[model samples]
Target chain A: MDGIDKTDRKAINFSEKLERISDLWQPRVIAEMNDYQFKLVRIEGDFVWHDHPETDETFIVLEGVLRIDFRDGAVQIGPGEMFVVPKGVEHKPFAENEVRLLLIEPRGVLNTGHAGGNRTAQNDRWV
Target chain B: MDGIDKTDRKAINFSEKLERISDLWQPRVIAEMNDYQFKLVRIEGDFVWHDHPETDETFIVLEGVLRIDFRDGAVQIGPGEMFVVPKGVEHKPFAENEVRLLLIEPRGVLNTGHAGGNRTAQNDRWV
Candidate 1:
């Protein structure tokens, strides 16, 4: 369904959305373009190692730092930067402090990918 | 074709990429996740009324303000904000000053969409 109505279709402020939630690692679906979903999540500490076999996941850091540990190495992402985990490559994202970032992925794709755990958030939860 | 090597897959700074180009309306591909591409563009003045019939377009404002005029109404998107123009709907994006933003769309979609003009930029150009 096209949700471009007057109420929520206005300029979605990032800080405003981030302030609305205190839970970490739970992605809040903010907007959708085509079949892809734009999600915002505040995550800290370690995450489950997983891989999405069908789609790549994009991460755009808005605040703090994020360290994505790959199978062989790790990449540290800073604020105002981004990184993408390719399809089928297992990765675990970690952050020392609270980090806010935006995730872009196809609709219905699980956050933990093939690794189902307590950290696996419900898909399509909006803030 | 996975470009997640140690070189370009690192964190991409938006301000650095926006500084690399002075041309308006041209989108520079910074990173790719699956079939979608993350592009940075700077735009000012007015753009042609266009619509991507095959896919929707996403615009994330990094600096300045963006006004998107739709068929029925218009939207003003500011820095740290975003707006998604639905598919098959006509829209014209304008800004009084240069606006820096990120655009996520499929790899081959043109900027001008069906309303091709001199403002049509070369796709897949990286900064």
Candidate 2:
């Protein structure tokens, strides 16, 4: 990414990723380089209880409301308000309606942090 | 930059930079980690000719029209249509009205690539 001089960093669209993945709750890699990954995830309702063991992931609400529930309290974010969940913190993210989110995290970030549950999707297929 | 776990990259507002720099035409760094830089620039009217020697900068029009004049042709982008100028291309950017743009480039991106002429500001001061 260091060579991305003003002339070299071309503007790229993230729409192509949206078309690739259909199922909800799974995140697909849209852009990646080295250890970083930019993923697009479509979510609805509440997700399984999980926690990342190694990396902290960022969630940017692209369209709808996102509620991140923590041990202490819950945070609600709209199209813009962003909250950073601490690493290894147990959390659950839910949305009332289908919401598009841009997730930034390191490579190898697992969708189900704590493994299988009723809400966990079967495939982590790249879309 | 790799360590920017989603937890670490807390949602930060770009409004702070918007307040610090009142003068037009100057780009200020609002966020930086390693080589990547997110800059905010407020613009008005037409600007002098300039070019980047190494990097290809990505410009996202946050507010108004941004017309880029190249030797071969011209391109006007509004809102989200992004175009990347190749390395070492001489061009002049102009705006018929006041505009705000988010510039993404590597560190050390100079505002005036071709030195003083008319639109060149006296300083490239960081806000």
Identify the candidate with maximal lDDT: 1
Q: Give the DockQ (2 decimals) of all models.
A: 0.60, 0.14
lDDT of 2 at B52: 77
Candidate 2: regions farther than 4 A off: A1-62, A65-97, A101-127, B1-10, B114-127
Encode model 2's per-residue lDDT on A1-127: one tens digit a residue. Answer: 1223444333334455566768788888655533555578889998877877666666756578888877656677666334556567778898999888767566676777656667655433455
Which pairs of residues collide in candidate 1? none
* CA deviation > 4 Å runs, candidate 1: A1-4, B1-4
CAPRI grade, predicted model 1: medium
lDDT of 2 by residue, B1-127 (tens): 1222444434444455566778889888665433555677899887777777776666656668888777655777675335565557777788999878766566676777655666665433455
Angstrom error at residue A56, model 2 = 11
Q: Give candidate 1's whole-model lDDT.
A: 0.88
- In angstroms, how far off is B8's CA in candidate 1? 4.1
Among these predicted structures, which one has the highest DockQ? 1
